[model samples]
Target: MLVKLGPLDAGRVADLRPYLDLVPDPRARRGRWYSLTAVLLICACAAVWGARSLDELAEWAERAPDTLLTAVGVRRHPLRWRRAPSRTTIGRVLGAVDGDALDREVGAYLADLHDASARAVSGQRRVIAVDGKALRGSARLTAARRHLCAVTHHRAVTLAQAEVGAKTNETAHFQPLLEPLDLDGALVTFDALHSVQANVAWLVETKKAHYISVIKANQPTAHRQLAALPWRDIAVQHTTASTGHDRRESRSIKTCGTADELGGIAFPYACLAIRVHRRRRQSVRRESRETV
Candidate 1:
């Protein structure tokens, strides 16, 4: 039978209970030995503390003190024999549950966190960066690699992530990840892979959010047109330089109000066009330059 972990105070383990509650139990009630919430909560806490695999998570739970298990909502067995679910139970429950639903629930929880943080800071605009990465250990065993689209803040707090199927790319999962997020007045940033016109329009018109996407050869015409602009004549320019790890890097950014030459294209609320040029040099004679 399903059970709820009632209101918990603001903390790491407590914050996860609401999201874990959304995961439907796939087990039959007649022979069930553990609640889904308790299993998930214990697993989440274990993962956060550096447990990478099911075996490791189970070991962590087994070694956990009774007080820690109780604090994380793990109930004592009716017979008072076990303080938490076994490793096999954790693996079975995780494998049987709906992965997509779990992802959505986690996203919703992070969105709530972002909203609360925004409120506490007096409406400060948050920066959400979208990127994709592949799981390191999953690639060797299967031809279909596991990739995930992660939305993170500038402060390095990961808000959410969505899985990108083997047949599809990050672009396919990009909008879906942002769909569940409340991005109003927030600035969303993405790499060149997501610099499509439709995405720009949707972010501005539908989501009512601002964006700063890198321009690249993916969109040939837009890249060429943006490159042809007379950036040297722009008045608003910012330049900075830094040196670290035997390398020196410098960047210059130029911004302009609007581009008359590209008037035909409908860029939603198109008020600014920016160009960035970067150069880097290492002590060993390696050098590179990039423009965006």
Candidate 2:
């Protein structure tokens, strides 16, 4: 399995050096002109800008700077570099390429990059957020909505993705989606839906990863145990405030160890129970308050 780097799009500095050589050439030598690697690289590079259709991808490649074209290995003819491949060519070649191979190689490269980044940051384990969402623009294709569960890095690189079954929910697909990645010693966070005992144990015992799970009404026993804690007796231990485009928000956190009065908040392998209160005031238009 190839442990790969993160996204290669703009604003995120990724090492695209190894990407060009990760996959083998799948085209015939008889009529090949453009480098297959260059085309694939262009598609990846353009992804962050939301390009997807063949026409849009090809257009982005054509407008690419000379430096990028040369770096991804666009052919340099005797007189000049050949133009980026056309939309028709891009469609044909990409259709013939091996998606599974590309995914593995990219995953390997991203994993390697994550490991190196960790070393530079004093060995702090990376954070992998596992979540799922409906595939936008696909509601018209299938009878049931197409949903996919995926794991992503703190830096926004996707490690893996798996389609959620029509007969099941995202929680059921969580373990399978994360089974393929190299997540040893990483910190995983998921919404309340995946805060089940089986999933948490699988992550710890099988994937060798730690998790920070949020408890809500989904798990009645745990939720009741946490909500019934003596929060009135505990002082707010930490507070974080942020100011953004049109809003100012603050969160005050109160944490209580499970060693003393609340020893029965049994959610499997948990040692602490925390509560967060959030207050948001958005300009002069809106305001809200919530807690978890």
Candidate 3:
């Protein structure tokens, strides 16, 4: 696994250098003998093995001292010199590391991993999904629930994120997050709460990213007017209907007209309206058994 990571990648490990550059022993510092790089490597290796807290890493340092040294590019297997630094030291180093810098380095490394996977496959599918999720454990800080707005590309890899003070502030964070992302050719999806005129216009005008957003009661007037439009009136059309053998049925409708007309449609009216109709028919077999 360590070999798979390509340890020599300069860009990826640049953030790790600050701690690594420190001389572990002042007396041997001039000779470049002892360094914090070993310590940093040991802690990282321990964490990779599922060591959560620093205390666990300290225990690993004592047990696998030699294996840990070589894993981190410490030059050679070590003869345990005075015990490894306490858990507090490891935690402090990790805490003191600039989070932004670490995040950038980590993201870049992960990107490389994904890039390798992309190359291994003949054709690559890159999909970026943008959504807002509340920090599950964060206590409500105010009357409005604060949401963590994150733009994740390829699922769990978070490209960027911001804290939305409230529903109204979503647009503000959206702009900043989109500004830095390379969204061209990516299908971006969001919920009804973000289906604002300015937001759509921005996605079209600024990022060149395609968007598909849900429409809901939040835009009441628009929703009502859209519902009233004749589906045949549209140029491009989409329709879906489904039936299942046992207690399942579904209906879907979609249509797209000229961007000009879509733009002209008044807010709370139909630029685009999607209705999901569902009906579940109880199986006759189940009914017969119940009756008997």
Candidate 4:
């Protein structure tokens, strides 16, 4: 099922006031022409509308109607006819704002939204995905390239993010991205890069949550052990099949029993060693009995 989020209303914009209010204004009061809240609201709205730079945000604000400005808490200017801030002012203010504080506030706001939505649709499991991405336009030869993020699977909302430094990778920053979240009853997922003993321990033991991580060749011992499991002998196996575009595919997944043959680097509370196999066939075959 797909849930479509509607357009943002005045009430929803007002909900962000408390969080944006926490961002300190670094500008001097004497020459301050616009309210900090108004500028932030404008930037946030512009960002939602796909504005990636300060100039684009300023252009969006310039073209915005008075109703949008007023709805976002922009008050009348004392001397000027317009209440919107210039692109330069927006850039300066944002540059001077504390990044860590802004991240926490935004993360908290998204978490609140997630919790409220989850309550509205009770009994459904929430899946949060952790991954890393590079800033497309901000790449530099000497600087680190990627930023780690924790996002929800369904709504694609980013709950938290941390920059991956030059010397460190996504693995080092994974735990910090998840530290502020309330993960109770949520199933977190990560790729093989994060499929380590520490992350599994934290998810299952410390947070009391469930997880599904890829077991890849990077973890040689775990991958080898899981691959050697007797999947055919397993009592319960799940199978799924699909056919489309002149091709047919089927997959079967099974879990191993609780035997100590795996090894000493055991995952905390680990009960299942899963293996999946996939087979595919095409509708058209060569005359020599070779399937393509």
Give stretches of model 4 more than 4 Å off: 1-6, 78-82, 217-221, 240-250, 257-265, 279-292
* Local distance difference test, each candidate: 0.76, 0.78, 0.57, 0.74
Which ranges in model 1 have alpha carbons more than 4 Å from their true place? 1-10, 78-82, 259-266, 284-286
Stronger candidate by lDDT (1 vs 2) = 2
* Regions more than 4 Å wrong, model 3: 1-49, 60-86, 108-125, 137-147, 165-168, 217-225, 232-253, 258-275, 278-292
Better of 1 and 3 by lDDT: 1
lDDT of 3 by residue, 38-86 (tens): 5566665666666766789888777765434544555543764444556
Worst 10 residues of 2 by lDDT: 1-10
Best by lDDT: 2
- Write one digit per residue (lDDT tens) for candidate 4, span 1-292: 0012334568878888898889777778897767788888888877777777788989988988888888887767666455677888889889988877877787778877888888788688777888777766666787645565555567887777787777778888877778888888888888888988887888877777898777777878767666666555676478788888777887777766645655423455556666666777774561112110
TM-scores for all predictions: 0.86, 0.76, 0.59, 0.81
**RMSD in Å for candidate 3, one decimal?**
8.3
Candidate closer to the true structure by TM-score (higher is better), 1 or 4: 1
Global CA lDDT computed for model 3 = 0.57
Better candidate by TM-score, 1 or 3 = 1
Task: Please report how far candidate 4 places residue 131 from its true position, in Å.
Answer: 1.7
Q: What's the ranking of the predictions by TM-score, best on top?
A: 1, 4, 2, 3
Name every residue pair that clashes in candidate 3.
221-268, 222-268, 222-269
Displacement of the residue 290 alpha carbon in candidate 1, Å: 2.3
